[model samples]
Target: MEVPAERVEPKVEAAYRALGERVSLPGFRKGRVPRALLEQRFRGQVREDVIRALIPESYLEALRETHLEPLGDPRVEEVSFAEGEPLRYRAVVDVKPPLAVKDYSGVPVSRKEVTVTDEEVEALLQQLRERAAEYVPMEGWPALKEDLVILDYQGT
Candidate 1:
């Protein structure tokens, strides 16, 4: 992928500005460091920051142009850049393979017959009956195992 110089320059400038804001030096106040000095001190970090910001956006744009969806993160390689020149990089990625239906006839499909016994049917019905069972308040005893305890409360 190639990102135009116009795109690359702005990001580089922004990176310098951001770095200048946080970096402190002996002669320069924070955010007032000279761009050339910042470049001298932090060239690699600034380039890396710009690349990190630009690559994803430019990569997605390139993918959209080619209508390709990558299966995973790209292995970015062979990145080259210069001032007043476009940023160039090679991204190795896996895309979905093309699919074609060669033949639909004689696909050799088989269906197995399913059978349910009367006992199974009776058991299913019993489960449904149990699920639908209702209990009314009974005069009497405290809750026991397997019994549902319901409570009533009033608050002011």
Candidate 2:
């Protein structure tokens, strides 16, 4: 993806201006620092801010231009930026591959006969009996772990 000089210049200028407003240096008032001084002192920061702003926007614009819908977040590979040059960057993206379908009249498939054994039937009946069991309150016995409990309470 390449962003033109016209688009890159404004964002770089804006980043410098925003940084100058908040940074105070010796002999210069806030927001009164020269662009040259800001560039000298904070060029890396300005570049970082501009790139953070431009990369995602440029990636999306590139996708729209080429009509490519990526499957996941892009891995940005290389980035090159200069003061007056177009921003050039490369990103690796994942996309679905094309599918080619063939004839599907009679695909070979195999089947196996299913049978239930006596032990399996007995296990199923035991599970059903357990599920059908009902709870009955024991009036005189103390409740233990795994017992269904019923509590009566009043709240004010």
Residue-level lDDT for 80 in candidate 1: 94
Model 2: lDDT to the true structure = 0.91
The TM-score leader among the candidates is 1
Residue-level lDDT of model 1, residues 8-122, one tens digit each, is 9999988888899999999888888898999998999988888889899999999999998789999999999876789999999999887898987978989999999999999
Q: At residue 58, give the lDDT of candidate 2.
A: 90
Clashing pairs in 2: none
Please write out the lDDT profile of model 2 over residues 55-84, one tens digit for every residue.
Answer: 999998888888887899999878999989
| Candidate 1 Cα deviation (angstroms), residue 59 | 0.8
Please, what is the TM-score per model? Answer: 0.74, 0.67
C-alpha lDDT score of every prediction, in listed order:
0.90, 0.91
Model 1 clash pairs are none
What's the lDDT for residue 147 in model 2? 80
